[model samples]
Target: MTSVVEHDTSDQFSPATSPAPEATSEPAGRDGDGRAARSRVPALRTFLATAALVACAAAGGTYVVTQRLADAAFVSLEDAVLTADALPVGSTGAGVVTEVLVTEQARVAAGQELARVRLAEDPAQATRGPRTETLKAPMPGTVSRIDIAVGGVAGAGEPIITMYDHTELSFEAKATEEQLRDLRLGMAARVTGPGLGRPVSATLDHVKPRVGADPLLDAPLTEEQKVAHERLTVVLVPGTGDVDAVSALVPGLRYTAEVDTRTAVGRIPAVNSAG
Candidate 1:
């Protein structure tokens, strides 16, 4: 059975080739969609930018309105100064200053000796030598001024040194009677000035009873107007725990003050009482 096997050599002779994938043409809308998306990018960015600008403008307008309302709620003082409760250190007795232990602006502790004085010899007294008197600081404070130098004569009860307590710092401002009516004790205040790092928070402390002639009243006026031109002093102390504001302030430094007169402190109480 060795019969000749007629193998299909024709199939083997045929070239091995595949039908080219039917020429895939992208959807006609695909290119148009891509171009449309690319064109929209700039418009989208521009829309976003316009939206952001509108939001910023609204915020700026709101801020301006808020600032105006805040200003309306306050009583302003153009002339204000940082100050403290001052103490005059005086000579205990008439004497000539023999030694000065401290200079101006010196920090002194309570009962610290500031100077020594040689008392004048009393002719009535049997003492042969002049008594030496020691001048001491009455409180812990900074020496503001030295009125007498070594060898200068100081009278009894005369101020030899002027000092102020730093812890008692306050802003002193001049206001008229009408402005005083709007203010109350414990009202909040804001202080701004050249030396301050930022606006300081304070509290209205008191209104000094003494009225002084207004230094700014330079224009000629009738006697009645002059009488009405008296200026009143208002004091504001630093808010509690604001030590940085107090430390940054130096006494006698000029500043501007704004007192919040619309606070509920005085108004609520008055309304309740009336009701």
Candidate 2:
């Protein structure tokens, strides 16, 4: 309790001379544990994003494939109309139809007499040269039309008998500009005529460039145009044998044709144009 000693004022200790250490802890992302925790969030996000992207791509691919499957495919037609124009027995000149022997729908043999063209001269046209009429056979087919009458004048090469081998015909299918590519000279074909619902196997005889030539093929477009009105015609001959199928096929029967399709066989997918 007794004595007090006073120190010099200039010798006092200042707060700056004894500064305290900074109080800092490790930051959230500084250590390996912190870094690992942070990395997990981004990895999860990436997985979710990738899954979503894959799903979207799969949907798009499916849509494209479905659309292509529904596109139009190539079809082969075989149904056709059986028709024939009877041809004259001979290459005889023009003559008068003196004796008409065969009637319409009359079945005639190969050498049966069809009509007798008269050589008798007309009293009015006696000044003209002598007429030479001769006997002719009806085309060896069931007579369908009898256009000429007795004593009627017949022109040269006139179709008195319309004859065609429709029992079984070989069609030379004409191709359109679109279906003209990649076709072999003897590609397989399928045919189906009227009265037959089934498809018949056939061969592609040939693909004619043009449907047919009018009187003016070599001439310019003005005289005649061979513009295709419908799908190009493809000729197909039925597979060998079995005349019974064609025997029932009456002439003038409407038939459908398939160049390479047989309904008996399943419908084929169209070839991809991309490849």
lDDT tens readout by residue for model 2, 123-185: 788899666555555435566666677767767666555444435555444444456443333
Task: Tell me the spans in candidate 2 whose CA falls farther than 4 Å from its real position.
Answer: 1-74, 78-86, 89-95, 104-107, 122-134, 142-144, 166-168, 172-174, 211-232, 242-244, 247-252, 261-275
Each prediction's TM-score versus the true structure: 0.68, 0.48
Clashes of 2: 26
Which pairs in model 1 have colliding backbones? none
Best by lDDT: 1
Task: Tell me, by TM-score, which candidate is best.
Answer: 1
Per-residue accuracy of model 1 over 1-275 as CA lDDT, tens digit each: 69897888765565664345676558767988999999999999999999999999999999999999888899998778888777987777799989989987787899999888888888888478789988898888888888888889999988777888877788888877667767777778888887877788888777766444454566687766655455567777888777556754568888999988876364422111111
Q: After superposition, how far is residue 21 of candidate 1 from its true place, in Å?
A: 35
**Residue 208 Cα positional deviation in candidate 1, in Å, after optimal superposition:** 1.6
The TM-score obtained by model 2 is 0.48
